[model samples]
Target: MLWLDVTHRPGQAPWVRLMGRYLLPPCKQRWHTCAAFLPQGGLLVCGDRRGSLLLFPCSSSPGWAVESAGIADGGTSPVSEDTGSGSEPSCLSHKGALPLEAPLSVLFGLHGKMGVTSVTCHEGYIYSTGRDGSFHQLRLQGQQLEVLRKHRPCKGLQWIEELRFTPDGDLLVLGFHADNFVVWSSRTGENLHCIPCGGGHRSWSYCSNASAEAFAFVKCGDVMLYHREAEPCEQRVLLESLHGREIACVRRLGAVEVPGHTTLNIFVTGSEDTTACVLALSERSRAAMPLTRLSDHISSVRALALASPVGVFGLLEAARKLVLVAESFHHQRCVLKVEAFLHTWAGGERHLLCSAATDGSIAFWDITSPITDATDALHRAEGEIQPLGGCSCQRLCSASRGRPRWWLLCSLPPSTTFFHVPDLAELDCWEVAEAGGELRYYCVLCGRGLEMLHGIAPPESPLLGAPQ
Candidate 1:
């Protein structure tokens, strides 16, 4: 296998010519079947058809990141040297420039049964479905993966083509080759709903609407939209339709919210028809509304993901005066929907929203802009900002030129970088203050605080926007 290292500047797409490639060791079984980026860091995990899982550290791997205070000679370009070959993820900085083929470490030797078809990561756990009809969960402990548990094999469940975890983490949905989808509990192996209809169950995505009531997926070449009558239970599909061609991908985009007008759900889909289509969904009894079509790509558009617009957007939406507070994801062990939360201390109270996890993990976050009020406790708190062990949100990072983020004080063993934060249910508040360029945070729940950074300059921080 070959890897291309290209430098892309803003506003420019990168182009790498595929000159040639090298062959790997002869394997009679299937080659690399699937690859995934680990949530913990930059480790790349790939599973071959022969049941062998390999881990590629990549030139941009996070190994060099943790060990070094700064990127040592980390720059743009490819230089070379031959250290021969061994099994371990390789980074470009360690080898000077770049290597045509970097050795990959073995994540799993060989499954006695079969190979993996679908792989996904949530929090610190990795879930994979194998050809042998098994759903396996692995936990990342340091650089190694410890097998946590695997679902009991179903007698005739063949070819799990796709897997998705609901935002609540209560459901583990599996799409099969036989044009049907099944839901199961992520923690327990109890089988739940089995909905069989439409096509493209082989390629499907689960996206929740603003109310978190509906989800849409593609089966065969058709789209099916379902509404949850109960919280994560009892679903009724409001609409279903067949596209003219194979539905390649469907993703839910942020919908426009109206005060009195019926809010229309919006989603975009790409197809083998070489066209991207937009459709509208209504909460009331009706069919999916077709919006417009654009034939941009020459070939099938394979994937669709949501991202913040790079250029100006939300300008008109901003005029609507939406005060953005915080973002959210699922934290299962803690029973909280979020794993960790962060904000500039200058933000006022309710500027912070916190809930506890069962594992003693807590996240406090203020989603919107800072409102100055000296009487506010959160406004006085500064500097001692850090995230917990199992934080899957944006990580605390540093660079030679960019600013450095502070570390969260953790009670878990020093070796543990991530924690499940399974211990939260009540309000755990904190306050911040800065003295002589150093920031300190006081935990109202634990009656403790840690001093964060010492030389934090004015431009390096915004929490100090108003000087005490």
Candidate 2:
């Protein structure tokens, strides 16, 4: 095994240094497959093809790292070149690296001939599993590894692949049997659940929170989610066919508060299938149920923008169609009823609204003023700003600095531009105070993963600000 030292600088990329190398025990059938580092530092546990767990002491006192630099050409060096240059190699080793350090202990035949597949250390005990359909626990005693317990295969679980423990300390074993993925619990030594997923070769994940446990796996080309609540409940597929095609964007609309019921959040999703879907997410059930699906777009629905207070939303399509939707919360039905909408921006004034149309025109309106019908409101774009180079604005956000400023996202060329609207009628504080307070940091979602940006406050920012 090769040991490496990695170092990172303040503003530059990290660099690695070669530390030391050690040789593993020789095996005829198979070699090391999985490994785990013990909770206590300087000790590594490796599982090999012969169903044995080997412990290697990587501490500095072992002389592997301490004397690695002074290891001369031949002074008790772990590596030795073969005098018979034509002889076949027995074990792999570094030519000029430090001599091999024998393992502190090796526990053999723990998983029989199936070979160890995974090794993990929890608390202070070592746990290993193999295709032999069982997992064994071992403890380090002096220089030897003693087998403490063996958990045999649960019914229907024939070949074990891996195991993990829940936050509550219940052991969860994952494996396959009869072409189905099975989860077995060590607390009861029984099958917790089974999902027919063809075989164990596919990708899968299992997670548990205080109230529920979730398992997701890929079957064929579709993803399946399974949920189990801490309290006994019937299982069901909460969402069916969320979209006709791949989803492109998702945005939270708002939250609904109802007495004695789960707090539900409203979310809107745009899809490549030329549709937008409204969903109600229930925290208690851990399910997202579709409330409505808007299928009026001619092309793919690529982006969505929402103005929650007035229930106005905008859906941007691949084609030049910007559809406006207005929805109202129906408490009795626990649903939102759509009225009419496009891309809406409520400025510093709540009554005065602005929207960007597909034809690249900006329209302003006094929503609180009298309107005979929806048709009147749609046609009455009181003060229309001329089209800007035929580029439709897909999104709009209003910011305030004594007067209202609008941020617009343009389509076709896909650019962001801000406008200082000084003459727009009646400004009500469209910009709401920050809900909790000024943010200390913010997160940006990127292709790789979420990135956190810290130091949100400027060097001269105040320690306290106006409360929400």
Candidate 3:
């Protein structure tokens, strides 16, 4: 197994070092659903198989604190018996003596709830759906969790998969079973429209905003674009038989300009079939056509994100490039994960392609140089693969920075690991002891490292070498 340090300063070659390994404490209950990052940062919201929600904060202080919103008898623990008098705990004080400010707000699901598969945030509002035939709207106002609105018996929307907000802040929900995709008003929770997506054994489906009136969702080898025209929504199947596999993630690359022609919108999709495809959407047709293919991974591609510049530039120049990170697993174990930085150049040509594989190995390729034929376009050359230390990463997200600064969340059972990219190096690790009760999720609000209370380390802090 190769380990890559997630952090390295710009312009300097990353150094290889093996840090101590840690494990995440086993939760009282197993978590089988997905986790999402908050809009501002420092907070991660996750839902469990049992329809329970947990918030985890990234902190540098002592003692980890988790708040359960809906689990029965499972909310924030009391600060101290004599601590403060209120419906909520004055503070969350752990055995490590770490103190957490009273939760700003907390939302609990209906009792004994199940099938809350995904959660997403936009413009300070949290939207969620579940198997219970419910759609929920929550707002975090100060330290209070208030339900803005709730719609039940959403009719055809059951087993919701993911929730997303369009660039215009309209709510979009992807569900499982019948008429799986629906769009709603963020403020009023009104169902704008619903579309029937196929059911059974699906991977992650991603939705990205195309225009104020249009958005796209990619899944199961197809990309569907929807536009709000009159009263109801209009739908178009932009691309089908894409990569011949289930789409894992999709991101709008921005736009590209063609001299003497209308601009084009580009979108990228990663799939389980080990391929990433970029599609160009024409303004006139509002239809996406295949642009490029990134065949760098040997296994299923788990996640994909375009560089901020590529995404912004796509929106600007109407030309967008993408950086795709993929994880390959065999027999349920991660074999190798690779990251690639690729761009589409002028005249819709595929240009630069840079990749880093799991063995702390990196490769850079220039796809501009023409070969004997257009069919043989890419030129492969090896760069440097510096080994950091870690087995594999569970989640990865890019920073809001202009350049590529990726945050990778690596799970090493019983320990929560954090890594940054450019040169994949470990930035911080928290050793979580196995405890019996269910562990909830939390996120830090401030990004300037974790804050310690009374000299006690915060459990969520990624800073290493602090007091345990």
Candidate closest to the true structure, highest lDDT: 2
TM-score computed on alpha carbons, candidate 1:
0.34
Per-residue alpha-carbon lDDT of candidate 3 for residues 1-468, written as tens digits (9 for 90 to 100): 111122334443222232211222234544436555577665555555566554555343323323222222433343333534444331122222432322233344431357466677766887666666565667665534456755542334456656665566455555554634555543333465556555534443444434335545566787766555444347654535555545655555566879988866566666665666677756476455776566436566657543321111111111121222221221222223323354655656555544444334444555444212222221221222111211222223333321223233422123232422232211211222225543322221112212111111124435422211
lDDT of 1 by residue, 1-468 (tens): 544444444433333323212233446774777777786665666677776556665435322211111222443334232334343224443443333443345545445346667677777777776665456677766666667765532334555544666666554546443555555543343455556654332455554443554546765567777666545546564533424456655555545667887656566766555556677756453346667554335466656544321111111121221222233443334232333234454554344456555545665654334322212423354543221111111112221222223332221111112212122111111223444645432211000111112222222224323321
Candidate 3, residue 344: Cα displacement in angstroms equals 93
Q: TM-score: which is higher, 1 or 3?
A: 1
Segments of candidate 1 deviating more than 4 angstroms = 2-25, 39-42, 61-97, 100-104, 107-114, 140-145, 153-156, 161-171, 187-192, 197-201, 209-468
Q: Per-residue CA lDDT of candidate 2, range 130-170, in tens?
A: 88777787888876788886665453455788888887767
Better of 1 and 2 by lDDT: 2
Residue 279 lDDT in candidate 3:
77
Q: Scored by Cα lDDT, where does model 3 land?
A: 0.43
Off by over 4 Å in 2: 5-11, 60-95, 216-468
Kindly give the number of clashing pairs for every candidate: 30, 13, 53
Ranking by lDDT: 2, 1, 3
